[model samples]
Target: MIPVLWHLGNVVVDLVLDVPALPERGGDVLATRTEHTPGGGFNVMAAAARQGLAVTYAGAHGTGPFGDRARAALHTEGIGILLAPRTSGDTGFVVCLVDADGERTFVTSPGAEASLTPADLAELRPGAGDLVYITGYGLLHDSNRAALLGLLPRLDPAVTLVTDPGPLAGDIPTEALETLLTRSDWWSCNAREAALLTGLDDPAEAARALQSRLGRGAVLVRTGPDGCLLHHGGRLVAVPGFAVDAVDLNGAGDAHTGVFMAALARGADPVAAAHRANAGAALAVTASGPATAPDAAQLDAFLN
Candidate 1:
């Protein structure tokens, strides 16, 4: 079985508060309700685990209440943890304010997730047929960024590197972005993130631009509700999304990515893998919480 080396470290507790509307500058508003769940890269990890993938999480999980919770969550999802050396700080948390429309805004607090080092990655040995998943959050942090960059060149040449630049793609330094693109075997991003990275509004064009920049990789541009675009081998294919009543859009993209990678590892073609991913993402948004991705049975039912 192919392993997915998930470079996920920022295991955060998300305090989700439902509010009528966002407050204006210097204003205040009362939240109707609040809930907590494992978040951050946990979303991606959980999603992949649900697909029955062999996933190893390579990140820091500190010794604290939040870390304990993250550890429990990972175990529950059957995800293997390759934590970085223990650090002084606790695990991180984020305050997510969701409006009536389910749009979310976040205020984050960094923690052990930012403590990744080259040494930690050196301990992880990925061989051919393995997929290494990375997020832009890791690349934005100074320490983690350096470690990730330094670890890239040392990875097995046949190991595929997949990256999701997240919302912070625009903030990554040009040199770092170039290096990441050069090393990436597959680039995944939502429409907004695609626009931020490529300055292209059209998802297809953005995928093409990213693929061109990567020179030898494929690109997947996710278009929420409308599905995703896959660009590879000088061809572009539109993988249509499933139509579902979305309750929360939080982990949909992460679910798509996780399921997509799992399908790839299972030897599915790119388009077929994307179809399965789209179904998984559709099911994800119909529920709540960041790590509420469907298991393989649920995904099979949804796809059927």
Candidate 2:
């Protein structure tokens, strides 16, 4: 079987509000535009599909408007949904306040996607050479974490597991984080996430420490402007990023993860894939939305 990206993470609706700046404590501030779009794990799945990887989503969703939008997006992106939607509640959403500087703050309220059952994931069966993407967001929820932990062992050992300990890496329980990291074949995250996870401010030291936590897998620590540090096997490589005027920071990391995994699945070495991923992320930040990750031709054009 060929490599397919199986995303076992949460998907949510993004209630994006563009503003000039954040409000003061207990103060109200409002401004420009608003958009409701699918985000979270959806960004990574979309990025992978855009790079020509077949993708599937096995996470729980609900039977409400947010869930409807989420499924619609998955279908539009040509991704398959393995689990049925929950009958009780709708999907979750994140209220994103994007300031003029393209930085964002989120207020998230998880809905049905926060609860996952072993039964909901029974249909998932990844074959050899498939790429499985796991996010740290699921570990934050009790039911989701239990279900995710249970599902991990069922995946074929030949399938590569890529773990991205998401934004709030500091919040994930240590045992759970270690279990996830050791089972995963590759770990990837940005500079801030690395610092938060390791409590070391320096990216290089953080990368080394995080890499040591794993059994034999590699680590990638992304430094926003300077590109990424990839430690594959035993060698550490510094891959430079393409500089662009970043208009939005959201989904840039997802773009990098998706494209990087896609490149690796398509037979590129870690360094080469990181180069492609850097270009993909650079292009992603130049756009305004969460799902703005470039497709093959677009990425090629940017690289050229």
Candidate 1 is scored at a TM of: 0.96
Q: Candidate 2 residues 28-56, lDDT tens each?
A: 98769899999999999999999999999
How well does each candidate superpose onto the true structure, as a TM-score?
0.96, 0.98
Error of 1 at 280 (Å): 0.6
Q: What is the lDDT of residue 199 in candidate 1?
A: 86
Off by over 4 Å in 2: none
lDDT string for model 1 (45-133, tens) is 88888888888888877778888888888888888887643659788899988888777788889888888877777767788888888
Worst 10 residues of 2 by lDDT: 116-125
Q: Per-candidate RMSD vs. true structure?
A: 1.4, 1.0
Cα-based lDDT for every prediction: 0.84, 0.90
- Which residue pairs in candidate 1 collide? none
List of clashing residue pairs for candidate 2? none
